[model samples]
Target: MTGAADLLSRLVEEVNPSSAWRDSFIRIPRHRFIPDRIWVEDGDDLAVLDRVDDPDAWLRSCYADRPVVTQVDDGDTTGRGYRSSSASMPSIVAMMLDATDLAAGQRVLEIGTGTGWNAALLADRVGAGNVTSVEIDPAVAAQAEEALGGFGVHVVLGDGEKGYPPGAPYDRVLATAAVQHVPYPWVEQTRTGGRIVTPWGTSFHNGTLLRLRVGEDGTASGRFGGNAGFMWVRGQRTPHGTLDGRVRPDHEYAETSTDLHPYEPVGDFEATFAIGLRVPGMKDLVVFDGDVPGNPHYTVYLMDPGSGSWASWRIRPGPRDYRVRQHGPRRLFDELAGAYTWWQEAGRPAHSRFGVTVTCRGQRVWLDDPGNPVSPEDPV
Candidate 1:
C-alpha cells in the first residue's frame, strides 16, 4: 500500500515546491482529510469510489496528484453532476502555498477549507493556533472542524467572501476556491504588506492563481500566474445549463458561415484565457458526434446564459467554411472571434502578463503594468 511519503515524492518530482513547504507536505496526510466515499468522473456523470468496495483504488485516488471531487451539486444527490467542491490538485496546492511565502508565527486566514488538508498543512507551517479557516458548506465544515480538532485549528462556518473579521489583520490570506472578483473583505482583514493568494477567473475561464500584496492604503494588487483552475466560490458561480436546454431546435437563429475555426480560440489555453477576459459571461463546450473514437465531427457551443444567447460552430474533417448559428439576443461566436482577433492584435500576451489592482472602488485588470488598464473597472 502506497503511503503519504510516496505521494510526497511524486509531488516533489512533479511540482518541486520550495524548501519551505517540503516538510508540511510530508507531515499532512491527504487521505485523512478525504472522505471515504469520493466521486470520480465517469463519462458525463460522477461515480462513487467507496473505500470499502475498493480500498486500493480509493487510496490511489487519494494519493494521486489530480483533484478529488468531494461534493457534487452542493451535496444534492438528485441534481445533475456538478462538481461543487474538491481537494485541489496536489501541485496547485503546493504552488498556492508557495505563493503565500508564509513563515512561522504568521496569522493565516484560509478560504474554502474543502477537506481541511490545506489548513492542516498551513497549521503545520504557521502553528495550529495561528491558522483560521472558513468554509461555507455546513457538512464539509463540520467534517473539517472535527478532523482539525486535535490540530488546534479554528474552522468557522460562514461565507468566505466576507472573510473572518475576528481574525483581523491576518499575515496571509489563502483561498482554496476561485472567485470572479477579489472580495474587499479579504484585503480589509489582512495587514498592510500582507499577501492574499486566490484563484481568479471569469465565466469563460475557470482561472489562474492571483498573488496580491495588500497596500497600506487599503488595497491589494498582483499579477496572474500559474495554471490554477479551481471551482468558483458559491456566490460567483456561473449559471449551469445543458446544451439541449439552452440550444433548442424550436429556437430562432441566424445562420452564417465562418472561415475561422475554433481551434486556437477554444483549444489554446492562452487564447481562451484572454478571450474570456474580453467576453464576459461566455461559457463554452465541445460535443463530439456519436461515440466513435478519434471522430473529428464535433460542435463548439458558446453560451451566455445571462442574455439567453448561444452560438454553435460545427467542426468536421474538411470544409473551409464551417456552419455557424447564433440564437437569442447576443451574438456569442462573433464576440468570441472579435476577442480572439483583439488578443492576436495585442501580440498575444500570456495570461501571466496580465495583472489586477483591487481598491475600495472596484477591481481593474491590467496588462503588462498597472498604469495601462486592459478593461474598464469592474465594480464590486
Candidate 2:
C-alpha cells in the first residue's frame, strides 16, 4: 500500500468521484482516526493489529475500503466479543455523504462517533465548528476526541438516542450506527425541511439506508436508499435472551404443516425488507440439520421476544410442506405467512420503493407514498 491518501483517492474514484465529498476524503487521513491497538478479523477470529508493532499493516488496514473494528462489545470485552464501533467502509461513507446532500455551512449532528473519522469528514464538508457528534461509550469518545483534537469538532459522551439537545434544530442528523426505529428526539432536534439520514432496519435485517426529510410539524419522511450494514445504536441493541430462556416448558403447543416457506422472502433484498416491515420484532433463526448423519433438512425458528411466542419449522427435503409447531398467544408462522402474502400482493417493493415517516404518532414505514403505510405498524 502506498499510503492512506492514495488508498482514499482510489476509494473515492471507485464509489462516487463526482461527490462533493471528494475534497473531504482527501483532506482527512483515515489512519489518524484509527487507534493504536485495534482488532482485525483473522478468518473467523480476531487478532489485534498494533500500529507500533507493524506500521505498514496497520496503515494498510486503516486506509482500506473495508470497515476497521475499533471497539468491540461496547468496549467492554477486549479482543472480539461483538464489534461495537468501527470506521465504516470508505465507499459506504462516501455514499452516505452523497445521500445527505450536505451544504458548506449546514449544522450536522453525528450519532455513534466511533473513531471520529466520519465526523472529521463531515467537519471537512461543513466547517468543524458546525459539526457535533454523540458517542455512548466514554472510552470510545475519549479516543475519538484524541483523534479529532486538532479539528474543532464537539464530541458529546451520552446516549445517542436522546441526541445532543444543546445543539437542537440541526440542519442535518446522521447516525453512523443502525437504529431499529428513528428516535423522536432526532426528528425534533432537526430543523424543518432538514434531513436525517441513517441505517434503519430491524434485528433480522440492517441493510436499508433511510433518508428522511423533516416536515414543519416535527415529522420526518423520506425514501430508503442504498444498502448498508452498521452496528446497532447502543441503546437499541437487542437482548441476547434465548428461546429456551424466554419460553416455559409447560407452555401450550400446536402443530401443522405448510408448503409455504417464510424464508423464501428473506433470500431476496426487497422481499426481506418487506418482510421485516410487515413482521416487525420477529427474530428469524435458521438452523441447518447438517450436524446429523444423512439429514438434508433445516429448521426455522420464528421468535417474538415481546409476547414470548415461538414457532419451529422442521423443513424436510422433499416437495411436501414443512411441519410447524407453535406455542404462545400469537401464531408466529401465521404472522410470517400473512406478511409474505401482503408483500407479494404489494408487488414485493424494493428498499427504494419503501419510505419511512417518524412523528409523535410513531415511526411508520410506507410504500410508494407516505399516505400509504406499511400493513402492520412498525413494532416497538
Candidate 3:
C-alpha cells in the first residue's frame, strides 16, 4: 500500500486540483491531525479504529477523501448518536477553499478548528500568521493546536458563533460547521468586501452552502452554493424532545386536503428551503408505515420545538390526495403549501438562484436580487 504522502499527492491531483493550495496539500499531512481512536461507519453501527491495533487501516482512513468522525455526541455519548465534530471530507474542504477565493497575505478566520487540517491548509495557502481558527470544544482545540505545532495559526478555544474578535476585519471567514443563522458578529468582523464561505441551512434541510460577501453597510448577501452537509454548530444544535412531552398525542387537529403531494414538493430543495424561511424553528421527520424495507406509505411530521405546534401529512402509495392534519396556532402544512406555491410562481428557482442577506437585524433569503425577498407575494 502507498504511504500517507503518496495518497495525499494522488488526492490533490485527482480529487481536488487547486494550483493555489496544491502546495498546502503536499506539505500538510492529514494523518497527523487525525486522532488515534477515530470513528468509522460500520454497517448500522460506528466502530472505533485504534491506530495501535490497525495502523494500516487508520492510515488509509486518514488519507481517504471521506470525513473521519473525531467526536460523537459532544464526546459524551458513545455508539452512534450525533457527530459533534469531525475532520470534514477533503473534497468539500477543497470546494470551500475555492469558494473563499483566498489570496496571498490575506487574513482568514476559520469558524471550526476540527482536527486543524483546514486551518493548516489555510495557513499554507496564505501564511500561517494570516490564519485564525476558533473551536468551541477545548479538547478539540488542544488536539488541533498540537497538530498545528509552531504553524503560527492561532487556534482560539472559544465559541465559533462569536468568531475571533481580536482578529477582526478579516479578509474572509470560513465556517466549517453548519449554522441555522449567519452570525452577525462574523459580518461585523469582516471587511466591507470580505467573503464568508459557510454551510447555512435550517432544520427543514441541512444541505446548503452560502458564500456571502460582506457589504459596506455591515450586511452580507450571496448566492447558495451546491449541496454540502455538515453537523450543526454547538450552540445552534436542534434539541430532540419527545412529542408527548411537548404536545398531546391525541390533540384535536384541523383537517385539510390538498391536491399537492406533501412529500413530493416539500422534499424538494428549493421548495423546502423557501418553506423553512417562511416557517422558522421547525424540524421535519418522515415516518414510514412500518419497519419493512422500501415502504411507500409514509407520513411527514413537522414539529415546532418552540411553540409545540405540530403537523402531520399522510401519503398513500397510489395517486391519492394527501391528508394534512395540523394542530396549534401555526398551520404548518398550509404554510408549506403556500410557500411551495410561492416558489413555483417565482419560476421554480434552483437553490443557486436563491440568495440570503444577513445583518444585525436578521437574515432574509431572496431570489435573483437582495431587493426581491423569497416571500414577496405572501409575506410571513
Candidate 4:
C-alpha cells in the first residue's frame, strides 16, 4: 500500500481553485512538513486539545483542512492550554494558496515559516528562488530550514513581522499567522499592484482571510475575503486581561433606524471585523464566558486609537441585562449589532460580500458589502 506521502498526493483536489491566483495545486510532500507529535482536538471542539505523536496520525492530520495546535501557553510543556505552535493543515494551506493565486515566476514573501510546508508550496509555483520566508522563533526557523532543505528558498531566521526586506518588490506577500493589522513594512516590500494575503483579526473571534493590493507608496488596501482561523504570530498574540474569574455572556444591541433582525452567524465578531484588521495597530475581541455568571460583564472590544484607544458595549445580564452601556469613541457592540442587523435584513449573509480598505492615516473595514467610498472629511 502507498504510504502517507502517497495519500497526500490524492488530497490536493480539495481546495477551491477558482479564487486561487494559480489554478494548480501545490506538490510539496506532506509528511516532510509535520512534527512527530502534534496537538489534535479530542473531539469536534477546539478547546479540549489532545496530543497525537503517532507518525501516521500526524500525517493524516497534516493532510486535513484544519491547523493543528503545536505549542500551548508560553511555558506549557504538556500541550494542554493555548495553542502556540503548529503545522497548518494541508487543506488550510491549499485555501491560503487559493487566496494567493500564485503563478509561476511571481515572487512571493511568506511570513511565519512554521514547518516550511507553505514555503515549499510557494516555491513550487513561484519557483524556490522567488520565495522568501521568515520565522520569529529561532528554533522554529531551524526546524523549517531542516524541513525545506531541497526547496531552494531563503528561510530567514527573523521576525516575520518585519518581512524579508532583501527580497523587496515581491509580487505577493502571504502570512500563515493571523495578524491584528497589515504591517506597513509588508506593504513597502511588495511592488505596486502586487497582492497581499494574510489571516487578519477584527473585533471578533479569529482571523479572516484578507486581500490587499499594494499602492506605489508602501500602503495596501482591500477587504476580507473569507473566514480563516490562525494563531497570531508570537508577537501579535492577544494578551488576555487579568480576568476576575468572570465573563459576561449577555450583550446588548443598538437602536437601529433600519429594520433590524437577529444575526445568523452568532458570535462571529471575527467575521464582522475581517476587513478592518488591515488598519495598523488595530486589535479587536469579544470576551464571552459561560463559566461564571454573577459578575459584571466583560465584552467584545474594538481598540485602535494608535495609543491603544478602544470602544465596547456592555450589559450585565445578572445586574441590569436590559440596560446597555457603550464605552469608547467607537461602540464595538453597536458596530457588531449594525452588521448583524444588516445581515438579517438582507437575508442571512454570505462571506464574499465583506470587504476592507486600509490607508496610511487610519484604517476602516466593511463586511457583507463594500461600504460607501470616503473622502478625507468623512468621519472614521
Question: Best-fitting candidate, measured by lDDT?
Answer: 1
Please identify model 3 stretches exceeding 4 Å from their true place: 43-45, 78-80, 242-248, 375-380
TM-score versus the correct structure, for each prediction: 0.96, 0.90, 0.91, 0.71
Model 4 lDDT tens row, 261-302 = 112223445334422332334455446466453444545445
Residue-wise lDDT of candidate 2 within 1-380, one digit each (tens)?
A: 48776876776676664458777877888888899988888875677788999998988888778899887777665433688789999888888888889998999999989999999998988886999999989999999999998787999999998889999879999999999888889999999999999998886677778999999987889999889989898777766676568656887789898888654655567777787777767777766686563456877788888788888888786787889889888898888788778888877777899898888767888889988987645543
Candidate 1 C-alpha lDDT tens digits along 1-380: 76656865676677666799887787777888998889987876789899899988888888888999998889886668788888888888988999999999999999998899999999999996999999999999998888787887999999999999998989999999999889999999999999999999988887899999999999899999988898989999988888899999999999999899888999888898899988999999888889554579989999998999999999887767899999988999999999999999999999999999999888999999999887889998
Tell me the tens digit of each residue's lDDT in model 3 across 148-210: 997889999999889888999899999999987888899999999999999988878786889
lDDT of 4 at 275: 26
Question: What is the clash count for each candidate, in the order shown?
Answer: 0, 0, 0, 11
lDDT of each: 0.90, 0.83, 0.84, 0.63
Model 1 misplacement above 4 A? 1-15, 291-294
Instruction: Write down the worst ten-residue block by lDDT for model 2.
Output: 72-81
After the best TM-score superposition of candidate 2, give how far the Cα of residue 37 lies from its true spot, in angstroms.
2.5
